[model samples]
Target chain A: MPHTVNCQIDHLSVNIQPGATILEAARSIHIQIPTLCYHSDLCVAGNCRLCMVEQVGADRLLPACATPVTEGMEILTNSQKVRHARKVMLELLMSEHRSDCTHCYKNGRCELQNLASEYLVQDGRFIDLVPFKNYTIDDLSPSIIKDDAKCIRCQRCVRTCAEIQAVSALAVAHKGAEMKISTFFDLPMAEVVCTNCGQCVTHCPTGALVEKNYIDAVWQAMDDDARHVVVQTAPAVRIALGEALGLEPGQIVTGKMVAALRRLGFDSVLDTDFSADLTIIEEGHELLQRLREVIRDKNPQVKLPMTTSCSPGWIKFLEHLYPDLLPHLSTAKSPQQMFGALAKTYYARRIGMDAKNMVSVSVMPCTAKKFEAARPEMCASGFRDVDYVLTTRELAMMIRQAGIDFLSLPDDEFDSIMGQSSGAGVIFGATGGVMEAALRTVYEVVTGREVPFDGLNIVPVRGLEQVKEAALTISSPLPEWGFLDGVTLKTCVVHGLAGAREVMKKVADGSCDYHFIEIMACPGGCLGGGGQPMPVSDHVREMRARAIYRDDAGKAIRKSHENPDVVKLYEDFLKEPLGHLSHQLLHTHYVARKRY
Target chain B: MNGLRELVSALAQKHGTRRESLLPILQGIQAHEHYLSDDAMVEVARALDLSTAQVYGTATFYSFLVTRPQGRHVIRLCRTITCVMHGKNQLLKELETLLKVRVGETTADGLFTLLETNCLGQCHQGPAILIDDEPYTRLTPERIRVIVAEYQQKAALESENSGLINS
Candidate 1:
């Protein structure tokens, strides 16, 4: 057993494992020492002195985040000295910070703002000495904006970009007064290797980094009489949108979300899950085609271990970092684009409305979706398929703007044709959902039996593990899939981009073999997206994942191929999974880029 | 690297191309090339198993190390309190008039580039300027003109011989 250190805090003694910081020991006994730079998901950077604690014999107060507890150490967590030190730190941060909280995007949700209010710091004692850095706001990227004035140099965004995403687009440049977070040689964000993932924005504690707002454009479209503002909600948004509207974090709010959209002046409320089902049929068949080429024809040139292309951040990541392996990525567009294409062509014609007159909008649990919608190839119907995309937080703002009582609103149904979805579509919000959805259809179609898991849930593929592996043996495949019989299909799910980097390294060296790999750019898939409600922790993501799986289990139709509307979509417009029309609208090629 | 391939490759071999050797490699390149070129940064990144972005970021963080191709004679005028208090403003104005360039610009003849920096740790020698690592202390406008003339004369002679140092 490891040696333990006993620390006395606020007259309560607790024993903790050696090498534990005072912050960890205090939190174990529920002492609640506050810290600004300390995050559950990052390395301990003791730059912020917010969590100062007085040691009995020490000359000065020590930061609880970085100071490890010694044997029989007596610590004062909330003494006058610690309180005064914390207040001064908060004042200094506030003095340098560009305070326009009332108009800032992160106004009520900022961590520094909350700490200042809690500490009762009326004003700063020192002069605001931080000089005005005249960097042009990088609005060149479609999704996020980086403002230097509001940054406090906490280094959380830099850590998030490097440690989690494996993309060092933001780095701490210079020293002391001139120090700031910057891209390579302080280049404009669009020219750098930023994947437009917005993970850095998600981890930022202040208003320095935020998603590009589209609420005004959505409002303008709603006000225009000729424009029919149609709305679609992503599968992940339903599980997380409630948090933005003051409800609990993990409740499935699909019905209330649809009702709120109707009240907010959208002509028709639709579901992106419907197109997710169509994506399954298309992507699943594409995988089958590759498998047939490799196994049946023994084709060496065919790309194996096909990667999913549903996450736009992951797509762009591959584009910038691993362009030579582009052919290995599935060509299927994300569910958002698939919905946008069919909405303008199939749904508009079915409703007897002009495609140009309809303004299609999507509410996603992602910032990359905004970037995905603005891509040049997305204009399939002679117009931008998705006119504007709003995040889940933005939808909550719209609901508030409309003065709708979201909690009390009646549970309403989505409009018919593009509204129907299956449990497979709902699970797409979680890390392993896409892979499981594909397996559910692919297994049954090939072997003529449902997946052996309880309620068809692939338990191995589900969880918060960075990389998860699973193998399934195909026995007595249906006559058409005779080549796959007795073949043990290897598969894996990579939850975070850092994990994907490791998986990619192994794949490149032929160290690990897998027939399929599912990769999500964000930590816990879309439930932990860059644009989700702030203060996201592992517990919050787990709660949201539970809600997603529960919703899937409760649904009547569990497989994507079983979704009625998607079958009709294939029958009426698409003709087949990878037909000429499907290729025109539902698939895209990636562009290679320099890593620097 | 067409011109610097031999020098950079030689320096990289001496330093053994590790992450810890990045600083020494950058300092060596700056000493030989006057500034870090993007191509040299890429080469260093490849040798050290680091990304080019990281290499560029580190190079830009220091005040002395520059990224852009510098002038033949790089002039660093001290902007610390002791120097600023010692008629540094008069010296700066006189130098700009003498060189026909502002604080960060190179001369039209590619002879000199003026820059402002913090402390040079020579508090007693107030109002100091470093021209190619040689410091001139307590300079007057007349002295500044002579310094400019010396670099300009050398630049003209080097250009005539087709052996200019700026490249």
Candidate 2:
């Protein structure tokens, strides 16, 4: 009957909203309730049990996070008992967690580390209490490392993996102290349909889930006199690399990033955007050919619903979850791979260097690209196309290790030949971006004229919505194209494998009728990748997404097809789209894996 | 279906198959089958993966898996919980008497899996178990047996044939 509930904050009476937690009510009046497990973006699981407060007439102190505040309830947040309980909770958590924070990957930035310092937990009572036998290692995956020894069992990683990313790759298996977060059936991470998006790593309170560091390999490459090390930075990497340099989260550091790479011993600082534009040129041609085949005979042999093959995580998902739809995926390798291939071939010829002497490195915001680099199918360049794959964080660490003053370094341009790219190429950092980019080029080729859409935003193919759809009307000069012929190019965009699963269901049931689809393994595109930043939220996603579009808008070239470097690349090296050279280097096939 | 004697009789009526062929049959059903959607015996009978009699034989064999369409609410009480507490004997006695069924038997109304498990891996919460797939901590015999009975009564209302039981 009463919506307003009276609750006391430190024995002071305050009316609060019904169904509000004690922490929520306390925070309204600036009463700080310290929390470790409570991430604003995620639902409260009350696992850490650190947010405890004493309620009058209650036998035991209540967990403020789990407890709902009631009317006329007196609460004591800083009582002796409450302090003791929170301290004990922290002690227990610290005991189970690895205390060697100095050497830990999450040393300075870990939430648990911050909590321990804030709570003044000098040492744990059970400091030497070894975690149970389940503190084993599972790092078969190229991108992820799972060392349960450091895990706090906060379930933040599990919740983020399931709720935010919607991959649901990790779950608490077994139970109690022996329980550990794991992929389905305790299978190796590489064996599962885990898109190496790294959301789990971002959400993890400790160093349990982490991106596999390839900085060592990059260092080795730099040390080798015979090796010509080339580095390509992903668009999203430029926007988020600032955070690693102690700059603001959304700060654009493209110039400093280039200078940092030059300092880090990269022979050339290339842009993945250049390769992204190339992907558009080649993939755009592939789409036209496929469309011609579809129109010529409408043969089922032709993969009608062509899915973008840019994200390795999505490629793996296609391999595992939608094996039947493998035909639908584009044969073109991702921009990272494409860049590596061109550096070995086109760049090698221009510089009069041997391809084997060149080591192409990619600094990406994605962990899946690590897996993609290791893939047997990715050696299209006669060597590993991209030899070393480092995340934005890893590159930042390397930059710091190399004593590069990242923040102070003036902005610099990427190397000529492969540095020039369009806004369409830069937008590949966001979800539905690849689809939007592909449509921009494909629509023109299909109609023999530029399609309408100011700045080519393609409003329907933009946003945080998991699945986005758009229809394009084809017209003019291309013989097959007529005024409307009712030829609406049906397109769908899916981010996250869980969303991919729903679309997959439609394809499996023969109900999905989209002509083209774009799938990103990470939610919010590569911007929310596991390797981008720690504790990624809607704020980070928005910041990074806005920064990516901003980078796109600031670009001199805005359309992928119109990139002069790409045009020259086609004429000088590629010969043409779907050409002998392009096919040999860029295209790949997928296989159906048997789950045992 | 209520007693071991009646269960034996039902097995006799259902058996055209031999016992030796059961494991593969059960494994096939678990694998090829999406969930335990078919009658355990019928699924056993259809295992081209195995012979019908062989499947029936396996269906009756494994204590870990179910052979019958289980209750809508399947109570997977951890025997490991009680055993670790050294109260398993007492817990089993209480559960059998309360549910009016043996440890391995489903009630006349199928609603629970009252079987003994080696370990659900929850040693800290000794005498712990799961009810309808949700973990219950610090389970006592009196509380657990009652929980099982409530679950069985709930499971009986839903047609066991159409529902899919994971455990």
Candidate 3:
């Protein structure tokens, strides 16, 4: 009935908005409540009762995460009863969990391990039930590994797959103690419709789900004298890699990252941004050609509203859920894949190294890139385009393994050839960045001038909105492109698979009219990727996005076509955009897959 | 595959194609197919516009909605506290011996499947076993043998009638 509810947490009075949960009220007062199933990205599941708090005169302790605050409610977040209950809950979770923490990939970063240490939970408090249960570890997927033994039954991954991604690839199967997160008929993740997006891995509280690490393989390649290991870092990795290495979010660490990669024995440290510019050239040309075919040629076969295919997760999502709409996807390869293809072919020749001896590796802020690199069709250069893929977190682990003090490293530049990029490529890390980058180039190509936006910043398509839209009316076009001087280009930018699904539904039913759409599978684009730093929230994504835009604004060349390396790439090796060589290496097709 | 699609579509149409319709559609399929096959679940998911895994999860959550190959007649024996207290174990052993199978196994002839389920809301009639849709309550080991024999005889008679019709 009132706009505010008054509550006392730990004898401290706090006034919070009505309909606020007890957890929210406590948070407003800075009273920390430890939680497991309660993730910032998902709805309250309330299955894990670790956040229980004592209520005055109540017979049972209330789950703080699920219980709403009432006026005059008195709660104790860390009373003796609450502490004992929390400890017991931790003990129970540990009893069922495989507590071999030293060998776990998430040993130091596991939330459950952190809570157990904070609560001083000793071993042997309860009998270990892991040996009795037939737990399985599914490592078939190239991007992720799911271990049922370590799962705390928190249902975070299930909720993430359903709530955030809108792809119910994971669900709770069976009931009672037999209940577990399972795919259809408990199929291996590789065989199912899993997008290989590691949002579940990032959301999991324990080491139940994690990216399939290729640290050892990359190290082996680096160590082999016969092999020349080349590493390309994605634009998103530069902003978020700092978070995993103890630097604050929004800290630009591109120079430090290149320096660390060099110190880690990479023969050449390259930038995926170089290939990102190349993608812009290729994808921009593809969009113009499609537009020409549709609008000027009056071709009915050309699909309008061509979608960006830079995100492997979004590509797979379209393949599985909207196979009929595959025709609308752009044929340009992603930056990582483009870099890999050139590294094995053109770059290998320029550097006087055999393609077979070069091991192309990519450091990305996505788990899906691992699966992308392993795609059979990715080997356009007569070899696996990318030999191994490492997430931002994995690169951090390698940096730590090599004993490199990442924070104290001196700034360094990438190798000369295939290492230069522009501001447009760097902004590809954030949501709507691809759209912004494309508009900056496409408008210039069409009108022979910069975009009409102030300071080349497309404000409408650059935010955390679920679906962002912007319209630019083209006028005074170049004579060659003068089909009509007054054609308005409608573009939509969306991040997160859920938002992508909504946009795609409109595209499928012909409900909305748009010329181009940029879709990223992860929330906040690649900066909030499933393979980025853990503990990702809107605040973290916002900070990383700020860093991306700031990095873009500071660069001398703000357009993709202005990148000198890209211009040289076309001049020396590839004659033109969408030319014969470019088509052979820079473009790919999609496959329709079973939904199940 | 086409028939399954048609059946799921028909069920979806009857129940109204919404999230709530998933359960009734699955029930309708299980009613005819005895258990949900992979193909059947995929068809249901397609008709309902849901993921196959979500359908499988829902099907496996309920004991009655089986998700594997099942016999023509399913026998669900209550294994709750009341039924256990009322000598349900002895009745189970008698049934297993007569049927020549384990607790979760089906008969060699594929006529009957025996499974243990939680309370069937027949606590008043403890030691109850459900065969097909019928409930036989207050069962002893001797009563279980007789009930199984009656079903076996009925199956044999039906087979004989079918054989004659085919000839």
Candidate 4:
């Protein structure tokens, strides 16, 4: 057993592990020390010295985040000296920070603003206004915006991009107070190899970085007399939107969200889950076709270990980092794009309205969805399939702006036809949900039996693990898929971009011998996207995952092929999966990007 | 690749291509190229198995290493407290007049580049400046003209030698 170290914090003697920091040891005993740069999910940065504490017999105070707990250590977390020093630090931070909080995107959600109010640091009149560099705010990217004037040099976004995502689009270009977060040569994010996963925005403490707001355009579409605005919600939005609107983390408020959208003047409220089911049908057949070519025909041209293309961030990652292997990616568009295409083409045609008159909008937990929708190739409906993309935070702001009491609103149902979805669709919010959903349908279609996992859950692929691998043996394959009979269908799931890097490296070396791979760019998949609620932690992500899985389990229909609306869509409009019409509306291509 | 890039590639080959060799490799590139180019940084990143942004980050953090193209001669004027107290601004003005270029700008002919340094670590020297790693201490206005003429004569000699080789 490891030896426990005894330490005292604010006169309370506690035993903590040796590796624990002063902040962790204090928190272990319920002594809450304030912090700005210390995040529960990221490595200790220690740049923001808000957690300064006085040590007995030591002349200088120590930062609790970078300092480890030792035996017989006596630290005063709330002494006058420590409090004064923290106040001084806050004053210094505010001196350089742009305090236009009322107009800022992170108005009520900013951590620095909260700490300033908590410490009552109104002024540092002793110091004059310091000279600082004036930088231009970069709002060119469709997904995220950067305001250098508001950055406090926390490096949370920098660490998240480099350490977690392995993209490293942002870095510290210069040193000292002149130091600022920038891309290579300070290029705009739109020109960089940014996946726009938004983990940076999720962990940012201030309004320096945030998702591009589309509330105004969405509201303008609602006000347009010539247009009938329809909104679609992603699977992850329902679970996490509650937290932005002051509800608990795990609260499933799908119905309330639809009701609020209706009140905001959207003509119809639909669920992207319906199209998520559609994606499975198209992507599953695509996977099976590739498998036949590779295993049965023994075609060397077809790339094995085909990766899922549901995540736009992962798609962009491949375009920049591994463009040569783009053939290995499935040609299916994401559920958001698939829903947009159908909303304008299939649903609008059935309703006897012009596709141009119907406005298809998306409410997503991802920032990358904005960029994905803006791609010129997403015009399968002869118009821009997705007119506007609103983030989960933007949707909450709309609800609040319309004066709708979100929590107390009556639970409402989505519109019929295009709104119907299966349990497989609802689980698309979590990490391995797509793989599980695909296997649920694929295995049943082949063997005429449920997946061997307990309660239809593919347990091996369903966790917060960075990389998950599983294999399934096709004991009794369908007549058409006899080539796969007796052959083990190996699969893997990679959640974060960092994990995807490792998997891609293995694929390149021909070492990882998996047949199918699912890649989700965000840490906990779509639930931990760059556009989620503030103060996100592992526990927050876990709560979102639990709610997504619960929503899935509660659905009566759990398979994509079993969805009644999807079957009717094939009968009335689509005709068949991956047919001429489906390919035109449901698939897209990617171009290689410069890696600078 | 250009001659400077070839020189950097040779330098990396000489000093084993490893992560720790990044600083020395960057220094070698700057020494030959007078600045670090993006292509050199990318090549170094690939050689060291690191990211290009990370390589650019380290190269930009140091004050001595320039990322943009510099002149044939780099003139650094120390603006430390001691220098400022002892008439450093006058020497800066004199150098600007003699070179016909302001601070942080290169001459039209690309012969001289001027910069303001933090300190020369010779604080007691009062006012000082360094030209291409050579220090000129306790300067006067007359000394500025003499330093410029000396560098100009050396540059002219180098051009004559290159012209002879080309012919």
Who wins the lDDT comparison?
3
Give per-residue CA lDDT, model 4, range B15-90, as digits (tens).
7788788899999888878889888887787677667777888899999888999999999999998998878999
Error of 4 at A573 (Å): 1.3
Q: How high is each candidate's interface RMSD, in Å?
A: 1.9, 13.6, 0.6, 1.2
Q: State each model's CA lDDT, in order.
A: 0.88, 0.77, 0.93, 0.89
Task: In candidate 3, list every pair of residues with a backbone clash.
Answer: none
In terms of lDDT, the poorest run of 10 residues in model 2 chain A is A477-486
Question: What is the lDDT ranking, best to worst?
Answer: 3, 4, 1, 2
Q: How would you encode candidate 1's per-residue C-alpha lDDT over A60-114 as one tens digit per residue?
A: 9998999898888999998999999999999888777877789888888889888
Between 3 and 4, whose DockQ is larger?
A: 3
Each candidate's DockQ? 0.49, 0.04, 0.90, 0.71
Where model 2 places Cα greater than 4 Å from the true spot, the runs are A1-20, A23-32, A56-59, A68-76, A131-134, A164-167, A480-485, B1-167
Q: Measured by TM-score, how close is model 1 to the native structure? A: 0.93
3 or 4, which is superior by lDDT?
3
Give the TM-score of each candidate. Answer: 0.93, 0.78, 0.98, 0.97
For model 2, what is the error of residue A520's alpha carbon versus the real structure, in angstroms, after optimal superposition?
0.8
Which of candidates 2 and 4 is the stronger one according to DockQ?
A: 4
- Give the fraction of reference interface contacts each candidate recovers: 0.51, 0.00, 0.90, 0.63
TM-score, candidate 4, is 0.97
